[model samples]
Target: MPDSSAVHFTNAFDIRSVGCSGDPTMFEAFWRETGDAAELVIPGWQTMSYFSDVGNVCWFMEPLFDQQVRRLHRTVGNAAVDGYHVLVGTGSTQLFMAALYALSPADADQPTSVVSTAPYYSSYPAVTDFLRSGLFRWAGDANSFVGDSYIELVCSPNNPDGAIRDAVLSSGAGKAVHDLAYYWPQYTPITRRADHDIMLFTVSKSTGHAGTRIGWALVKDREVARRMTKFVELNTIGVSKDSQLRAAKVLGAVSDGYDVGGGGASRHRLFDFGRRKMVERWRMLREAAAASGAFSLPAETSGQCNFANETAANNPAFAWLRCDREDVEDCAGFLRGHKILTRSGNQFGADPRYVRVSMLDRDDAYDIFISRLASLK
Candidate 1:
């Protein structure tokens, strides 16, 4: 098999409409080279039952799925799972809501305030208030929020800006849910093993399997796990067992590539492939920004990645581009006029001069985007 890490970029660019929804389809090439390492073929007769484990709090969680989740975490050294209870969700979005439901007080007179730092995940506020649930309400930026009771979302390598973050609110009454979705070595360096009270992760970001719609949460408290499980039970009954099994196979395959006893000669290491692509893409983006002269990007940051055992740059999944041109106040609009779609910074509670561009699109779309961006004066 050809080395998945070595990708060839052609000068040929296709001028087509691009949609940047954090869809991670770039990893398709890498997975394609892995043969059947991540493939799954589940018989129809299997996974027919609604129940997976009745004795466990998360009764719907398949054992193999649970095992693979922990195994991959252990192999990557990105999260601590020794004492955590893993709860599966339809997606991390469901688990995120579950965290809000589990953390908020049921007897409180007012809705629990949910806040994250400005330039937070656009979905956090939208998802929190969509139901208008009395349990929790979107409370804007955590930096300005003055409350004793709140659930703070700490998305490290934050969605819009990709900054390493922690809970902004430090009140004793405030609880934190760490969204470590992009903590994988590909996007950012694994500086430490994350050990938070409630942590959210998804196959979408981690393994680039967004179609699977599989996400899981690690809860330090059994009661919290039970409540989160209850939220999933009420919301979706249970996550799809087929998706879970496929996710398990994918995750296990990832671990296999690194295991000394298993597939030692395997050329399917996902992180190696991912890091190479991200680094190259970031280099291209920086060059584009420099060539444009009207655009700027966050200074590249680097750290000692424990997983890679070397200092590595934080090549974020999203490029937070700022249009410095005096006439352009809305970067998204400016990019939209150029046929390069991106999420506006205003939606992330920041200045309109900035926009969040997905760095994980297919080669043709990304090539077109960078080319268009570079041509802008």
Candidate 2:
């Protein structure tokens, strides 16, 4: 009733999508800083690596598959699940489609209503539309469902705005699938309880290996897991075992404390460091934006949306700011001219005054952003 359908452009600055945020781990600089000068070991392994050529699976599949799944298990708290299946796609975007197919019915009378919380991952509706002709409807308000819906896709530390809500798993009529694409230690503290039976994760956010095009799902219900496996089969037969192994190697290294996301002592240490940096950067960005007095952000510099119970985010990687000023019609272009590329909030079903800002980047980048915004005043 509050006209929640409209989103603003400034809200885009609040998310860490690819390229914009610039993951240090993914960059060569990160490895250089770690003093690992070796030129990618794994002699015969990488040569035989069919992660790119997933369709070309040979005898090296099974063992590689085992190694990868185990590594993933260890990384994600080692939850229990039988029948290890791996499917590699171009990116987690493909996996998102696979998840939808696994849940939606082909011949159901009511086009399965796909519901995700407000200010969710921007890709949810896009993927759903491309995958299913049926279309995904957004669910507004935490407690109140937008419409009568069954399948719910919720993102922890949601995109556009890092709002991590307390969602539970209730079987039968109410089912929830978690899009935990950003559940890595560097982005946010790992506090999500595996108490739920169904969940999903992507290598892009966790490993900074978005190019690998690999991701996996964790489900408690044996039947649901089986169906999901079947969905993978239908999508592309199976994920590349080579990618699985590679991911496994990296995950193993992470579990063994060999290669952490932020290269800090523990995942917590990495998270804390990122939190501090994000807070420092946000302080400057917020101040600059505040000078205009046209933007609104989370109460705490921590970027925690208390409404979503996103307490774990001491400081969100991005800043979700809203511009309530009556003058500006286009916030995205306004920032783009200043060389600050951000997403428009309309895509998130929010007001036009909102724009998202990625706070997790080099200090220099943040400084430039603040300087640009300050110039606007």
Worst 10 residues of 2 by lDDT: 51-60
Q: Highest lDDT among the candidates is held by which one?
A: 1
lDDT of 2 by residue, 70-165 (tens): 555555542333543443443556656656666666666766666666666666777666544663443443345544446777777677687765
My TM-score estimates for the predictions, one after another, are 0.95, 0.72
Clashing pairs in 1: none
Worst 10 residues of 1 by lDDT: 8-17
**C-alpha lDDT (0 to 100) for residue 325 of candidate 2:** 58
lDDT (Cα) of model 2: 0.56
* lDDT of prediction 1: 0.91
Q: List the RMSD of every prediction in angstroms.
A: 5.3, 8.9
> Mind giving the per-residue lDDT tens digits that candidate 1 earns over 1-377?
35543332221222222546888989999898988888889887999999999998999999999999999999899999999999999889999999999999999999999999999999999999998998889999998999799999999999988899987788899999999999999999999999999999999999899999999999999999999999999988999999999999999889988897664637788999999999999999999999989999999899999999999999999999999999999889988887788889999989999999998888878888888888989
